[model samples]
Target: MTPAIYSPDEIARRIALFERIRHPHKLLSEIHRALNIVRAEVNQSRADMVEFAKQNPGMTIKPSPLPLICVIGPSGTAKSHVIKTYYEDVCRTENWQVGRRAVFDFELSVDANKRQFHVDALTALKDPDPEKGNESVLRRRFGKLTDKLGTELGLCDEVQHFIASDTGKRTKSVIDAMKKTLNTGICALGLFGTQKAADIFDASEEFGQRAHIRFDLKGGNPDVADDRALFVAFLKTFKTEIEKMGILISTKTLEDAETIGCLFLQASGRLGLCQRIMKAALRVALESGATTLLPVHFAVAIDRGKLLFGIKENHFASHAEAFAD
Candidate 1:
């Protein structure tokens, strides 16, 4: 049920608040710096190409293979979100346009074959007829399109979909297509997926060498003091953001140590899961006409989210004092 107090505009504002509460993590900064390095390399390559063209008119110049980064992580760590956020920030700040489409992003289809993969890549490139070509034709078109679009970076999510659950020959074909794109020097590649996505590099040593910058996005560990502090700080920040949206959360709602422990346990130290549970609890509380957030709301949220969250035990309900002093 929609809360009576929440108009459509207010609901959108609250959602925006929740979505934008991204914690500034070290990985974010690292990826940003690494992409800057890639941009620099790409700029140098383009400069070299221009100089060569001026020196030798009417000559074909084949660009060298560019850099590649693989961002592998478990589910609920928001790897895709992190990569997309970086690109979005860069494009917005630099006022990038179609002629400067700094990044092209797309997700691989489940069990994606070479044909489907190229079609998806072309679709991301805004091809007028992504479906109008054979696999070989599509592959060449995608390469040309990337060059025409001035794509400096390519972000592919769910990369495991192509590499996993495929025959050896099929896997190599798709991986080769990916390699071909990079070899053309049209764009640097940032592949994001679950740990299984690492299989792409394992299958091809050359791919691994090109993608030397690998980041394993680890979730928090409640047992570690530093990690626990980080999660607690994130929860506090979440509380502040929600309050700014006029959610009327109690001071102790997410600030108390016991509550923090409950959340950590519920989410298995995944900040993404914590955010999900908190958002669900807010919906429950608002629909029930609660003026302030409470543990009971979270208990309900856990119960509702159990099927997907897979927590056998509802920590908020059964043992609220599990982390009490």
Candidate 2:
């Protein structure tokens, strides 16, 4: 028999059912709610930033809304995770509005020629001509589209791609166009990248001063104790939920899992990595027909992640050092 081809409505219903089942502890629910709050705040901030930029376009120096937050840190400091987490919290506070505005991640890339940078800004605002190729046409229509929809745009990822070349006229023009669009206040932009990327902006006095908030993750600051604690709590909660599903994870194994998790965080600072580790561990345990998660399961998960991330198992220290802090 052929498999059923589900309609969108059917697919949505199935998704809802799965969410309710898998997230009985409300972890996914909380994440959804948090995203909503972040969306609203991002919309408001975007509008405010656009207006401020337009009002003082010619001003060599001007203040921005709060500190334009620039998350700067090493490769594995979880800079992206921090931004995403904050965005989720903002969304949750707003109760996850059905039609509310939101901020989104942006990405930048360069072509093989490397002469120009690409800025892909994700927005809830409808694109009048989703197929429009002309930058001018998009800009002129973007304002009307955003005004009518009351939606906002968000930018993230490769923020450095938005910066135009200092000497090239075309590059400058492109950058100016982006700046003007941002000034319209339709959405707030959030940038997430490595320290080197942040340095690209810092090197330019014009862009450097525009950043309102700078979060440095490499200072060896002890203040992250709270964040670390929260992460540990999240892990414990996740482990409990898995156990309730009839998966028994031993205490020793859980400690080992946590140790591996901390190392992943230290290397990539990506929460996605942490989740992958957990999922892999659970899958391996299930495959073995074992009710409990064992050390081997964690070891397998860590090895899998390391391979995917192009890193080595030896790169991470043992749990002894992780627990010491």
Candidate 3:
């Protein structure tokens, strides 16, 4: 029997998902949602594989490999924060007991060779002198450690290091090294990088095909209501977090649609930029001994930020309008 081809609607739906994973500027909540989805999927995959193994006794069961989740975004979008938070949380008992590892995290290097990559992984996995071994030995040791650790997930950060702008290029060797390090047929990989690292995956058909969970994250888009609402939620979270450090501000203002919209514009819809603005305002409040943050404080903070960040040309001239009089 011939295989059934997907209809146009199905194909379009698939393409939409593809594009969603490819586009950056995703909100933090969205990224968290994606990670949770990945966790559940890995769990189910583990369960199914165990069941299959029991039923088939002597047979080799090939569980579907988890997709490599490439968290890609611009520099200021809090991509590192997202990856770090998620990665650390995933490294605990549940993942490990399920024969899944929260792989040690390492930053990729531009000048790094394959041997060096292995050495880095081995070190992250707790091997003191991974540099002592050659590629073959390192690979064996690395694989052994992973098995011992019961790690199913591997994380590589700063993947943009593999993209060399000086030569205007990305090398296939680095890509292959990534595959070898994370996907050596034992571990599922999660990579974190900027657009350049994402390019590495898009250009390589083999990598792209396997990277089913590519998460392109960015700051919220100002024009999108859902985006703004999510950012406001993040602001509320920030308020709660900051209060733990003895500073409390009214995130209640963020609840106002007009106020939040203008703040979002000033931030250019980027959470990092929003944090910078708020943190600067917090500093001003700290110095003034003011516990309640007012619109005027944020306006001054925004101006100061323009000079400090060399973003004078993009000043928020009318941001004071967001102030609740």
Candidate 4:
């Protein structure tokens, strides 16, 4: 039997449904606020760096000529969460009065292959002709955009394939052209990726040196006194917020969550994972037809560490058995 092909109308309807289902305005708003907070943090970080630079005038580091920052860490480390929160916060703070804020996220994962990168970036910039159907014309148009923005266009992602190790000469030329626009201070680039992404910057001495500041989320370990207190505080605060929303969590559930959080901290002590745990617990509660999450809810939420962290399912299963018992 032949597979059914979607007709044009069916395809359009599916697209509409997908957009409606996937695009949650409220969630997007929340995400926007989160990102703005991150941007503010980035700005503050930049300011602090500038002051530090002044104190050490001869320091090898220079001002981040481009607003590009590479957030690197293992999976479930909260790199994406941090970036999203920062982006939302930045947009909120900037758009408060004037309502003029421009923020966009370019997923390098989708365009990690050749041809797609150019298409994605150009389409994002709303280039008149993204096809590069006319190189000279496209360049002129891009130049105008840079001149107007007064800064280089920014790009964000885990690892940009455009700058991959095996990129060819032609690809390099395209990337170089993009870099030239940035060189004139018309754009600022931001990068988000896993620890392996460091190699991308390491590939080029210039890019490597550009990324000077680093933030790594160390999982808060309960065995460690400081981390224990932090974990408790995080859980307690989360509980309070959920309770305020008419959800009351049982002490047993809290204890279970604590155990889970500690296990996570022991394995991958990133705050990002902590947040996800809480998020998962809340989701489980909602799914169980209970306004408050109880121990069972947490149990339901704990599926190895897949829903916990990004740990392998089998590995997490062993750990989960130990924790569940």
Candidate 5:
């Protein structure tokens, strides 16, 4: 799903809906009428820092290195989406327009390594010559380019692959290369990775040290009241949105609290997974020409994500009865 930016009134209406939904179909339509923005501390913090970095070019970079923010979490945790949304929004600001390529977001492939990392970085910066020189020369040129282009911030997603393949220190050198370029006191880094990303950072102590501010989006805990509430809200909004899209859901398992808790557990508290399964279920239902989505459709969706769902089959089996109701 696309990250959404909402108006103040939309935000207010969303909040009201969050408290209680009078009309599932209507609220779902509202959710689709445009994406809504939920103000979280992490989003605001990133926005503020980026804005400040753009406003005062030399102060922060000089006083200390452009701080790095590493968002570590599991797949479907919205790690990249959150930062990507923030970067895209900030880049559209007037301050960011003076230098078109000042901010960028790029994803790393599963096999990305040192050279490829630099190549990708250069490309993300929109550099004309990504392969012009050796590592050292390339880094220097990169620094000069950023200094020239007024580059400020960068986002690198799925950096775990780089860490996983750095057995011979090739990938570690990539960080060293990046540090050299970052000496220009511009272009702070935002790195997104999964739990394995821990090993990536630990592999390069210097890179780990540079990541001063770390934001982690752990899976929502159903045992925790706050987490439970958040999960419920997420589920309700999702259900409403689906209904609004014309898939009449006959399964109250999604609407009930206890049953939904089991679902959250089955999905391992990842909204992305939950959303994906729902979409898949809807697709199956629509394909079959069914007028409504049922528990069986959801079961197939859940089973498709078996290895990743992280739920016990017996426990999930118990929920099947409730899912049918």
Candidate 6:
């Protein structure tokens, strides 16, 4: 494809528009609802502690554990995207102190253990010397930082890494640390990962009991009528979104049933992958100086993304057939 000689400003403007467009998803609402519930519980817990402290000065207060919210999904389900979006929204809406952070999100490393977990948590909290302290000291620092930063939530991403083959001791240590944090009454916890994480949560009676709300992000089944309808509707809505961003899409091709089916197969019915493919398609269309985003642009994007994402097939590619009736 020949590159169009676009001004730097025009390219930036197009990129900004692409970044701003987001497909609305129902799972976002579920996450919001869970956050609201946890927030309410934390606020009440804080208020109760204040009242109790007033009544009994210099007395220790042990608060009950707050409920956890687990966001379980496969890769490309946008678990992190939705959580980060909510975190950004919170940062904007909340009038906290300048240096204080609201949400601390950290992904677990492959060599995840009790010590590394605390180190990662502290790092996410912006602790200046996360690796300098011992495990006990690091855990204490994490708790102190969470309290000081007025953190409302702590998100643990890719938690499956934390669960080792010897789940007895190692898993218990990490789980105990999380339970200790919850017991500290500093911040609510939210876990995000694939189905393996969900299985771990389910297997652990403590985590299972505490995590009453679990949001599962699953891909759509193309054979299912309702699922197919939802996927088609999402594409139509995206057409409107791109048009609003001043990118004209070929209406006839975009609205065609066969084209939509090809899109569904290429995207594997995952919204994250679908959006990524579309963004790549937009870039292809822009570079090619296409007046409108055509099916061929999407096909090229699918082929490119197939290699990038390790997708086995490119349904939109010319060699592939349309969805079978």
RMSD of each: 3.8, 9.3, 14.6, 11.0, 10.2, 3.8
Task: Give per-residue lDDT, candidate 4, residue 160.
Answer: 40
What is the RMSD of candidate 1? 3.8
Residues 1-325, candidate 4: write the lDDT tens digits.
3323445564344333322211122333453443344455545545676789889888846344543455566766656665555544454455533322245556653334444544455566666666664555555555465445432235466564445446545335444554553453334555666666666554565655655344444455557887666556645665555554333334234446546554454345555565555556555445434544554444445563464455443222333343344
Give the distance in Å from residue 278's predicted Cα in candidate 3 to where it truly belongs.
2.5
Candidate 2's displacement at residue 35, Å, is: 11
After superposition, candidate 2 runs with Cα above 4 Å error: 1-67, 74-88, 92-100, 109-119, 122-128, 160-178, 218-234, 244-252, 256-272, 315-325
Which is the winner by TM-score between candidate 4 and candidate 5?
A: 5
| TM-score leader | 1
Q: Name the TM-score of candidate 5.
A: 0.68
Best by lDDT, which number?
Answer: 1
lDDT of 1 at 252: 60
* Colliding residue pairs in candidate 3: 25-217, 25-218, 26-218, 100-152, 101-151, 101-152
The C-alpha TM-scores of every prediction are 0.89, 0.59, 0.68, 0.62, 0.68, 0.88
State the lDDT of candidate 3 residue by residue for 1-325, as single tens digits.
3323445564344333322221223455576566666556666776787899899999985557565777888766666677655554444534445434555577776666667667777877778777887877988888788767766566777887767645533456666766665444456667888787777765578877877577776767767888867787776666555544444434455456665666777766777667667666655545544555655667767776786643544343555555433
Please report the TM-score between candidate 4 and the true structure. 0.62
Backbone clash tally (model 6): 0
lDDT tens readout by residue for model 5, 205-279: 877787656666677776788777777877777667655543443544578666576668666777656666666
lDDT of each: 0.77, 0.48, 0.63, 0.50, 0.60, 0.76
Residues 1-325, candidate 1: write the lDDT tens digits.
4435766566555656667766776667888788778877877887898999999999977887888888888887778777767866676688766565777789998888889888888888888999897988997888688777777888889988876554567678778888887777757788899988888877888778887488887778867988888888888887877777666555367887778888888887877777788888877766665557778778888887888876688888853343131
What is the lDDT ranking, best to worst?
Answer: 1, 6, 3, 5, 4, 2
Weakest ten-residue segment in model 6 by summed lDDT:
316-325
Runs in model 3 deviating more than 4 A are: 1-66, 87-101, 165-170, 240-246, 249-262, 294-325
* Candidate that beats the other on lDDT, 2 or 6, i.e. the better one: 6
- Residue 210 shift from truth in candidate 6, angstroms: 1.1
User: Residue 68 deviation, candidate 6, in Å?
Assistant: 0.7
